[model samples]
Target: MRKIILLLLLSAFISGCSSLSKSQIETVQQFGEVTSNFSAYPSAIMEELAEIRLKRGLYYASTLTDPMRHLDELDSIYSQKKYDYKVSEKIDVTFRVLDKYAQSLVLLSSGDYTANLQNNAAEFGVGMDSLVNLYNVKSNAEKLPAGIGEALGKIVGFSGDRYIKVKQSEKIKEYVTKADTLVLIMTSNLLEYLESSNLEELISYEEKMIRRNYLTYLQLTDTGTFESQREYLDLKSNLDAAKDLKALTIQSTKDLQAAHKELVQVVQKKQKLHSTIKELRVFYQQVAEIRETLNALKKDK
Candidate 1:
């Protein structure tokens, strides 16, 4: 009888172990930069609302309350950070976290997961801390890295589809859905202000007055004699340019109204996004595919 012994050895590639391609890095940077100007939109509406309320009086007079009550309500929403700022800051922080994840993935792709994991993990926690600070609800920053870890886990599994499915957890879906909801609320209020208040008329009147002033200025410049013929010709040329501003202003107001109407239609169509989980899954999968392509690029390099 002969004694027999068998042994097996295999290599496992850890996640984030490839070098990144230029396009991959650019995509990550671009994705990070794409963010909604949530606060600006609402702030603009509030400013318009306040101006119109002062110029034309509040949207409507209540049977009982301060006459500026409606304007005050808008002010309160803006000042209290109940919606606009909340939504804006929240989305911005989310973008930051995503950028961090993208960077961490790059590190992993570079075959430096274990060495960089500690510091990368710390950055993720800090990012989450910034994020949770914006919300009224509580969240542990440590909880965030777990998701990053899970995403990193996909490296070993080598299954992008499965990884995407894992990202579609209920918690993540709810967060994405709620973020979208916040935007809807912010935009809806703007449309409501436009429809219910005197903002449209106020804006139009203000623009009309501005155009009138430009015309008045043009007449004054034309009537005045210049020291030289070139001076007079230059003034005349600039006058044409100044007159064109009136047309631009008109177009700007029309464009605003068009955007306002389009937002209204979108809100009507996808009221709450009951399939929020599916939406998130699809979105995350796209991000994942980008990451995958990035890994492949680095590997080829």
Candidate 2:
């Protein structure tokens, strides 16, 4: 009777220790990979805004009373203390903090954490601390709660030759629960920026300018030259491409936010790992498409 009871207790303990299956860990790794990939997009969008403004300024310079003076003014405005540029810098920092967090997630879930575990954990903790500090300085916001760093430190600080699945689940659940709100804030800020009227207004103004210029040229020339028509077509093509990219970027950002929310649910065991996997794979594919589009645009430039 005593032997049977001891065997039953041992079996229960072993079962409890196997909380996070291999598939679940792999799903987490996928989530981290997609997150790291997605981090560059917001900064790129800001760059696109600056580029468009500069191009628009140059295009309209001929209409100004003193064209040369207008050109100088445009240069100065863009070069010094522009509000949009300042906002862009803050956006960059916000994404950096997010990317760092995603990287820590990858490191924790990866098989490599077993080697030099303490040193690696401490190193990641320091990196997280630095990013959080940068976020505070750049955004002029209160510092993120210290608990996020502390919880993450605990996640990586475990000692053992074998990676413990049960501990991973526990620490990840705690971290995800605490970090979910912060993640939502970062992602929501991005969505708000993207959905704002500033970008749409800029794009609309540029389209009108392009069309007006082309029409004026046609009227003066009584059927424009091949070069003129080609220029108009090229301009239109670029504008169309930019518009398409904007739509994709917005969708991708939403997908990222949704995936992170799903991650929180998965960690809490409120959602099945398989269901999360499907969503993650979809996000991964969408990001890959965005990457390809960005690359094509760069090459065209």
Candidate 3:
């Protein structure tokens, strides 16, 4: 009877151990499934967002050249009026090439290209806002030339005593100063965005292809030169920092909430810098136009 009782006790112990092992295995499998689902979903969403944002940015940059195209059209019109068919044809051909280039940029922007899955999508919207602001500035700058003649006429037509002339001169100065302030504000906003954004590294890799573009506007504006070389260097630094950030981000990935928050901050900074660089381009273009107009007026005199 004692032997039978001991055997029964051992049998029960073995059964309990097997049940515990099975339970543990199920728990681990469930955990893994949860992790896999979380990782895949967020990564896929982020990648799609990044691609869209990059394309949008590139497209906006291409569109920013509409002013230059319009300027070419004006030049062609003037050349035609002067019976300079050769110059007009040349301008038209150049305009066509520019249009094609712009279209290509749009296509490239829209093309299916790979983007870092970890990049933050919300920050991209901020960058887009900066680009929109730049577009508005460019539009305003284009309108300035049309109003300049009228403003100048108003100043010249005002025949008053010396005191009145002095007042008018001050008023004109105020108007010019206000316009300049707006340009400066827009330029500063753009620079701030670039400096804050970490995208400097990405831009640097593409700088070789973009250097000529950088130089063209720099020559036209007095806003200050863009050191393409410096930009490249900064971009390299950012890339190194980004590697460290990526590591931190990856480690924290298991904690989805924390990782998401950290990455968002990193991406926001990068977008800021991207926006700044774009704004700087617009500022340079505007300044160039102003300089050209001044030169033309001097020649006319």
Candidate 4:
């Protein structure tokens, strides 16, 4: 249905228009690509990071010679996800906001000016909807900050192409910049928390390993005193080493988290994102306001 509408609309707008012009193919295509880039919730990322962190601690504990050495060997494993986090953070704000800008033009071009209009539940694309859910916007009454959903809705009602004149006015520039800043801040915070969570979890894993080792030794068979005594000494030594490693990991985690206190506050509270998102939904509200501001600017021009 969307493709049909676009095809019909394209007949009028496809000629003599710059490819990347506001409502042209390039803008829509770019938006589609960017929209597809949305992946992983912040909470999910942190959870996985926590798990991997614990897993590494266990792996390290298994290597009695040097735990950090085993962790160092996991460089390849950790780097892959690290790259993803970096790429996700580098979202094309210029294109994303322009996508929103172009969508507004499409709506305005067709005389569809109702705020937050939607053709169907699926119109906003998975990217925007995931964002909507991530932000915990339960209903339409819960206005999204920064006009994100509304901006998406504005575009959704206009699949048919028209020779829409889209321009980047000053307010639009501010809107784009603000949106990009929010994305950067959001991604950075998530990645930072992931880093910290991984470190913190390692400490936890080490503590558990220490306790489990102690219990296992307690249940050991009553072999000769020599064998039993040596096993007990080795267990105690391993426990001491684990405790030291845990202390170091804890200090490192705390230090890193403290350095990014503001971002931490944005991404989490009590190991979850529900409360953080509720508080941070204000940023979405700010985004929506920018969309309105951009509209007013377009009108003024």
Top of the candidates by TM-score? 2
Displacement of the residue 126 alpha carbon in candidate 3, Å = 38
Q: Per-residue alpha-carbon lDDT of model 3 for 1-301, expressed as tens digits? A: 9999976875564444322122222222222222222222212222322332332233223334578874665555454334421222322322232222222222212212213210221233233334334444444332221221122223232232333333333323332332333223333332332243443443444334344434443454433325544543443344333333333323333233222222223222312222223332343343344334334433422
How well is each residue in 91-138 modelled by candidate 4, as lDDT tens digits? 233224324433432332232323343342125433453553444333
* Candidate number achieving the greatest lDDT relative to the actual structure: 2
Ranking by lDDT: 2, 4, 1, 3
In candidate 2, position 96 carries an lDDT of: 77
Give one digit per residue, the lDDT tens place, for model 2 in 1-301.
9999977886676565545556666777778777875667755655655555555444444344576786786776478426555566666766777887788777667765564664675677677777776777767544575546556676544433333556666666666667776677677767777788988897787778777755654554465668656656766666776777777778887777778787776665633455555566677777887787678668656
The Cα local distance difference test for each model comes to 0.35, 0.67, 0.32, 0.37
Residue pairs clashing, model 1:
16-108, 16-109, 17-108, 17-109, 17-111, 18-109, 18-110, 19-298
* Candidate 4 residue-pair clash tally: 11
TM-score of each: 0.28, 0.75, 0.20, 0.30
